[model samples]
Target: MRALHVITGLGVGGAEQQLRLLLRHVPAQCDVVTLTNPGPVAAGLTADGVRVIHLGMRGNRDLGALPRLTRLIRTGGYDVVHTHLYRACLYGRIAARLAGVRAVVATEHSIGDTLLEGRPLTPGVRALYLAGERLGRATVAVSPAVAERLRRWGVPGRRIRTIPNGIDAPLFAHDEVARKEARMFYGLPEDAYVVGGVGRLAPGKRFDVLVRALAELPGDVRLLLVGDGPEQETLRRTARALGVADRVVLTGERPYLPDPGDDAPGVVALLSAMDVLASPSAEEAFGLAVVEALAAGLPVLYASCPAVEDLPPDAAPGALRVTGGAGAYARELLRLRAAGPGGREAPQAVRRYDIAYSARKLMDVYTAALAGSTLEVSSP
Candidate 1:
């Protein structure tokens, strides 16, 4: 079956990565369209032999290009149009409907106001989006938290389908030699305990808070930050001011996985090198990175927000979740680091999140979406 996948941009993020993974494994023919033109994700699509069209939208609600989008969808004759992210989901679904596609679907990777950190969207905009969200043949929630949030916003539970995000398990499974080699490449001290944080360098992600936590640790503990974003400079300054600049390694936007074997084993290796994974995201949809760390057999000290706490129990063990505030985070760091069981063996807690298994579950979602069956959101 022919399908059209629409997204905001090709920049690195969970939503973009999810599309990349879906493109690699979806059991159907697919094409991608980027409303904000091409970026890193475009290369992934091209590598997959999937056609990617760039519409070059100048700003939000740029209807000047709607006719072009409609023509392309009609000409492609796709049976399905699946959208990711807020802007694309809003406009792309309407465009797909206008093109008269048989099915339209959207995956809400994070809650609606993730940009606003769980706050309600402006009343008018919320109403408008609530109506737009219901336009789809099916709305997929990447996690239960996201689905429940949608329900609170007036979207019927009947229209929401929860699908937890999946990772390539083998990609995150532990590797000792590779972990050492990765640390050596970064000139990290062999005996020093490492703490790593991965994800976009944005305010909501709270990378500065991670730096603060790193400063609270002893000198032997170093912090490694993967990925890049608009707040890179601000975070760099924070590290410098916190007097941990020398101990911080910022590998801006490193490869997700150097070898396809683990999708992005470099990340896994970094996780293996850490005594603990610190995910201080104030808001997260599914905590994919936390799950990856668990799969790598590393314990996590993450934010205790509903999104992170609501993750399946199978993925949460020996996990020190902090819910209070900055002081709470510092206390947790001190507690975990003092009794640090630095990289040892892969924990048995991660088996349920195996990539192959999750991929199979996702395939079922694709099959159901294609067959027009409504999917139910499961309880966390």
Candidate 2:
């Protein structure tokens, strides 16, 4: 079936990268629509031969883009219109309904009890989201925690479906040679014990907690902050103030590499190079990077990651949920280092998130939506 996927922007965030990976495995013909800033991720989609339409939306108040998107959806003759992120969900659902699309679905990638996009979940925003949600046949949550949050927000239980984000497991498998190469490329000593964190450098992510935790760790232990955002300068200053400036390496923002084959030198390589991964964010919807690190056979110490917490310990043997506080994280780092330099192999449970498996599950959702059923699928 022909499908149209709409998102806010094509930046290198988790939701955008997840769309890129999902398209690779989905058998149906799919096209993409980006509201604005069709950045690097758009180029990757084009290279893969997918059609990406950019709607030049000036800002949120730009109502003109609504009619434009509606016309495109109607003209494209898509069987299903799937939306992602905040702005896309708001506009795409209305546009799909206006365009007379029978199957409308949206994936709620980021939503928490306290915040939505780093801001408080005000009542006004909740009202608007609930209104928009009614236009869709189903809303897919990336984790059961997210599904529970949706229910708390007053969405009916039948309207929500839990579909955990999938990764290309084998692509991130640990590699000794690649690990050495990644360390060399980043100018890190081969023996340096690295603690890495990947995601948007935002206040909500609490990357500063990692900087503080780094200060408490031994001098030889280094911190690798991947991705970038408004918190870059703040994190840099925090590292400098804490006297660990030399040890903290901020790689800025890197392109999202969905399929990192054995030799691809992007995120997968960075994950391979790290001894252990640390995610100190107290608020996380899914923790895609944590899962990717697990796929790369790196042990993860997370403070508040719903993705890993929802699973049993045996499901992700390498993941450990630590309490909030830099000292707590520092202690965990020392304990992990004492064991070994490299992380343990990924558990067999990680295979549940394979992109192929997710594609099949998504097809079921699409089929059910087309058939006019709001039945929720069992979580993986």
Candidate 3:
């Protein structure tokens, strides 16, 4: 299959990194086109031997980009055009249709009750979304909750496909040697209990809550924050105000999945060094980091994870649902600390969300779109 993927930006966010990882496993001649902001992931894609093109879009309302994208798609001879994120989907769908490509697919990676791609959803946004959705053959929701959200937004049930995100479970398997090395590299005490949070540091992510919660914990307990965004300074100031500045370690953004043989410890070693993972985001299309932490045998506290809630409760035994806020997080951290549930066995969710399996499922969706049909499967 020859596929062309159009995404809003190629930054180091979850959706962007997921695209890079999925392409490594997809067995198709795939190319990427970033409408704007072709950052690190674009380079990574090119390094992986995939052709990448920058569309040079100036801004959201840049109508000039439409014609350029359409001309590219028209000349690319692609069997399928897949779009990701909100802005890309809106423009990519229209461009694909204008270019006479019938097999168009879009993945709705983040659609919450009142947010799309971490921004407020206005009536104008909804109108454009619906209009573009009509042009595509299918819209893939990362979780059943997201799929239901699409249905509530009036997208036809037949056009909605529920395909959850996936991860490489064994790649994150816990390692005691890595734990020591990561701790040594970060100057953390060997006996200290580490609490970790991983994601873009945005206001909606509620990482400030984690910072405040750190102040309430014992002096020996430490918090490790992963990823980077505009809220980094705000989080640091909050920690300083609460006198817990020394207890927080911000590693900035690391690769979502890194090569294992590299000298530096990737996300895998960081997970091994932590005692638990906490995600305080109140809204999410799918809780990807929660699944990766489960694969690492770490207990998790998540505010809203459709990824776990969509499955049977028994699927992720190490995961616990909690409300968002500093007080709530502080109380839960203390409670879990007292419980002292040591490293656990990888849960059933690990195997269920393997990245290899997800790539195969996506290829199935691509095949169906090309055939002008729907791929049916059992759903809850």
Q: Please write out the lDDT profile of model 3 over residues 47-125, one tens digit for every residue.
A: 8999999999999999999999999999999999999999899899999999999899999998899988788989989
TM-scores of the candidates are 0.89, 0.96, 0.96
lDDT of 3: 0.89
1 or 2, greater by TM-score: 2
Each prediction's total of clashing residue pairs, residues at least 3 apart in sequence or on different chains, is 5, 0, 0
Go through the candidates in order and give each one's C-alpha lDDT: 0.74, 0.88, 0.89
What lDDT would candidate 1 get against the real structure?
Answer: 0.74
Clash count for candidate 1 is 5
* Poorest lDDT segment (10 consecutive residues) of candidate 2: 256-265
Clashing pairs for model 1 are 169-355, 171-262, 256-264, 257-264, 297-347
Q: In terms of TM-score, how similar is model 1 to the real structure?
A: 0.89
Model 2 Cα lDDT, one tens digit per residue, 188-291: 89889999999989888888988999999888988988887899999999899999999988886666453454233578778888999998877778889998
Tell me how far the alpha carbon of residue 46 in candidate 3 is from the true structure, in angstroms, after superposition: 1.9
Worst 10 residues of 1 by lDDT: 112-121
